[model samples]
Target: MSDALLDIRGLTAGYGDVPVLTDIALTVGAGEIVALVGSNGAGKTTLLRAVSRIIKASGSLRFLGEDVLPLTPEALFARGLVQVPEGRQLFGRMTVAENLMMGAYRRRDRAGIDASLAQTFDLFPVLAERRAQTAGSLSGGEQQMCAIGRALMAAPKLLMIDEMSLGLAPIVVDRLLDVLVAIRGQGVPILMVEQDVFAALAVADRGYVLEHGRIVKAATAETLKSDPALQKAYLGSDS
Candidate 1:
């Protein structure tokens, strides 16, 4: 945990006066893809909301070794902590390029921003092809790609993706997993909350199993993939 780029200890958060996540402890270390897997209401999204400062969380939170518990959402964004929300929240009326550019609103480096844009387009070629197209007009998979591309536009140090495979075909999910690995190769660690447990384990170096808002299991990806209880719980098969 000493090398963790993002660390959370004793984190608890939820909607107004309603507790959801309880005493959550999670970490994403450098050059690693750490998966958080659980059922729909297991506080997966709530934890992300807390980390991004969209919801208040009480805990010892640190990012890049700096205590970030008091930082505002805007400050967190500027610090290279980015999240790709669960629904692929794209600005429907805006062009693909425009939406991506919005990720760099806080940045003043014109050259770096342009370079990052080119990098994003290269990563998701479909986005480049539809650079001028309105986000609302894209297919579901394309929209997801656009959402991720927009996050990469920010040049994030740590990328947290919620439900990257939601509503996409298995093939599309595989492609995005490949992208996550590629992103990791580029030195950006990822903390992903995935609906597809197998897909998440396949690419992640490690995984944390969340049950009823608490971490029940944490292990290497292969260990988790072969865990009997998890196999039956999520995959519905032990074979």
Candidate 2:
């Protein structure tokens, strides 16, 4: 349990009169990269939303052995739980540096925040070069990099990302995956909800397969990637 950074059991959430997620259970251990993969409307994004307190939910949601179901989104951010949402939701009018600054809105530590900013630049050198450019003017992949860098400015313990590979070239997605690995090496666990099953499983330590708002499978990355049933259903091949 000490190893677990995010422990979710029987997590049920949805919009009014419509259930989007039900009975979801998963664990993200400290410094581990976990993937949640499934088809459209499988509730992958909803799961991350619930954890980040963007929506109402039920059941036990724990972070670092403490019940976090009652925490507000602001409180969650203070606890080092941050989400880099889908679609790279950057402020189109803001410069890259201003966008990153927005992520540290909850912090008052000047030195620490500056250090985090420097770390972000180190991780994504292109961001450093384009710090003054408006986010809306950047290419798709550069926007994605800025989004992740902004999240890191929060100094998150668990970074949840949704559809990270969406609308990006394959090469860009691959580069982001490598960056995620480096972030994990620096001790930030990640919960990635990706549509690209093969790519997600390749970098994840473990993965949960969500279908129809339920978790249908949980296993090590190798097992999930090699499972004949999973391969046939999601990867478009049985091999």
Candidate 3:
């Protein structure tokens, strides 16, 4: 068996009685960057919600070899299955440092939290430059960094990010993607649901293509990037 850190099988979830995701199965192995590519309304965010327990879902969901279907969102997060939602949902009024400190709320070890915060600042020096600044006052990219830094402070084993490059400039996106690679090098697997197929596949080790709430393709990043049909369908390129 592969060393899968987060595994989902036969997952079907939706709002109330309506199903948006159907028989979805995917896995994020240790130290892998796995991207999920799809169009709008394809249930990418819905799948994240289901996995995080923000919404109800059926079937098996495992993390670090533990069955997570029975855990509440808070419990799952404490167990190191953390999510950095789309829109970089920071506590707007809170200072960058305060917002980051929130990520370690479940932890009791003071020294470890301090080390994580220091590591986060070291990774994103711009955040260190703005630690006391209000999160709402930062630029779009800086806010995204803070949001990601906050997740890092939680010491996540698996980081699930939605629309990571959304509404950001190309340079900023590149910077964020680099950080993701570095994080993966440090043995944190990422399950990224990204709107930018090119950007996501560029750094991902593997990718899953979802269309209309169902995964239509799953392969290595190179395979997905090289597929002409996938390019036509998602990138709208006739060539």
Candidate 4:
């Protein structure tokens, strides 16, 4: 836990008087992929927003050994903390290249941004081919790719993706997961919120099962894979 890249301690966050997350504690170490899995409205997205400082939160959030709760969203992003939000929120009217350019808005190093763009294109070749096309015209999978590419344009150390597989076909999800594995291979730590428990756990090093804004289970991916009780609770039993 001391070596964690992102650490949250007793994090309680919500909107005004309406509380959504209760005493949520989680951590992602260097170069590790951790999945936060739960049902809808279980506060997974709210937790991510809290970590990114998009929502008011109470508790300690430390990133790379520095206190992160005080930082603004842009400041947090500048410090290599980026989140690919739940919906692939792309500029529908802008071309693919332009959308990616938006990711580096706070950056002054044009040369570095271009180099990162090339790296992103290399990671997702489809985006390169469709650079001139409007983001709205691309398929859902392509849109997700562009969204992730836009995040990479910032050259983040910690990339948090929320529901990357949402509304996509199974085949597309599989392909996207493959790209995520490659991204992890590049040594970037990822904290993901996924609804597809089975698929998420298959690719995760470890997973946390969240319920009603609280983490009810935490286990290694292999252990969770064989957990009959967890299967019945989260994954659901065939019976």
Q: How well is each residue in 1-239 modelled by candidate 3, as lDDT tens digits?
A: 44588889999999999999999999999889999999999999999999998899999898888889988999999899999856899999999999999888888899999999998998899999999999999999999999999999999999999998889999999999999999998889999998899899999999999988899999999999999998887789998
User: Which residue pairs show collisions in model 3?
Assistant: none
The parts of candidate 4 lying over 4 Å away from their true place are none
Any idea what lDDT model 2 has? 0.92
- Taking all chains together, each candidate's TM-score versus the true structure is 0.97, 0.97, 0.97, 0.95
Query: What TM-score number comes out for model 3?
Result: 0.97
Model 3 lDDT on a 0 to 1 scale:
0.92
Which stretch of 10 consecutive residues in model 2 shows the poorest summed lDDT?
1-10
Scored against the true structure, residue 159 in model 4 reaches a CA lDDT of: 95
Per-residue lDDT of model 1, residues 146-194, tens digit only = 9899899898999999999989999999999999999999999999998
Cα miss at 49, model 4 (Å)? 0.8
lDDT of 2 by residue, 112-160 (tens): 9999999999999999999999999999999999999999998898899
Clashes of each: 0, 0, 0, 0
Q: Give the TM-score of candidate 2.
A: 0.97
| Residue 223 shift from truth in candidate 1, angstroms | 0.5
